[model samples]
Target: MPGTTTLWRPTGPAELDLVAASGWREWPPRLPEQPIFYPVLNVDYAIKIARDWNVPHSGAGFVTEFDVDTDFVSRYPVQQAGGRDILELWVPAEELPEFNRHIVGTIRVTHTFPETA
Candidate 1:
């Protein structure tokens, strides 16, 4: 436990598909219209987005858990945007490898949600 580090990313089923296909090796790329990769500071926040926004709008959503290098905490400053606590990293498509470098362990699916409407 002493050497372990963990982080969470909540996403929709489509994104989770990409993650599974990647062997849990990468976070799915943001859409051309999306500008940032937001991994939040807590599971509750992730769940809020997954349920209130993702599942309803996208038909499905997920809550994922993974370990990130401890240094990641220091590398990016925590952000509170739109009144939510998140880590907002400007990870353009070209910079994905650099972003992946900070992720240290398996990206596992911890929870899944089905479309409610």
Candidate 2:
């Protein structure tokens, strides 16, 4: 806990605004069709998703950085596919606040997408 630190989430601009407006405390509720909240492990993966996926479709993409208790995060499972280096947790909508409580600081938008094209 001493040296260990933050996790990052890549999302659309709408979600970032929601996080900011909610007093930097909670994540917005997931839509009916959406069941999981994914906070990726690395900025590169986050940026890739934000740029290639979120920005093109949503018109605005954002990467959010925050600190969470690694112990709390360790309680969940991590998903990793073949070559993606996409380590992430699948936090269910109902458990979001529980996850949020571990977050140490205000989630800030680290990057905005479409740096080109």
Task: Give lDDT: candidate 2, residue 59.
Answer: 87
The residue-level lDDT of candidate 1 at 73 comes to 47
What lDDT is obtained when candidate 2 is compared to the true structure?
0.81
> Tens digits of per-residue lDDT for model 2 on 1-117?
433357788888788788988887778988888888888888888898898899887887888888887777888777894456978888998899788877876788889875455
Residue by residue across 1-117, what tens digits does model 1's lDDT show? Answer: 224356677798778889999899888767887767777767777777887788887898788887776665456666766664544434456666677766777798777889864
Span of ten consecutive residues with least summed lDDT in model 1: 83-92
- Please give the RMSD to the true structure for each candidate, in Å: 2.6, 2.0
Q: How well does candidate 1 score on lDDT at residue 116?
A: 65
Report, for all candidates in order, the number of backbone clashes: 0, 0
Which structure among the candidates has the greatest lDDT? 2
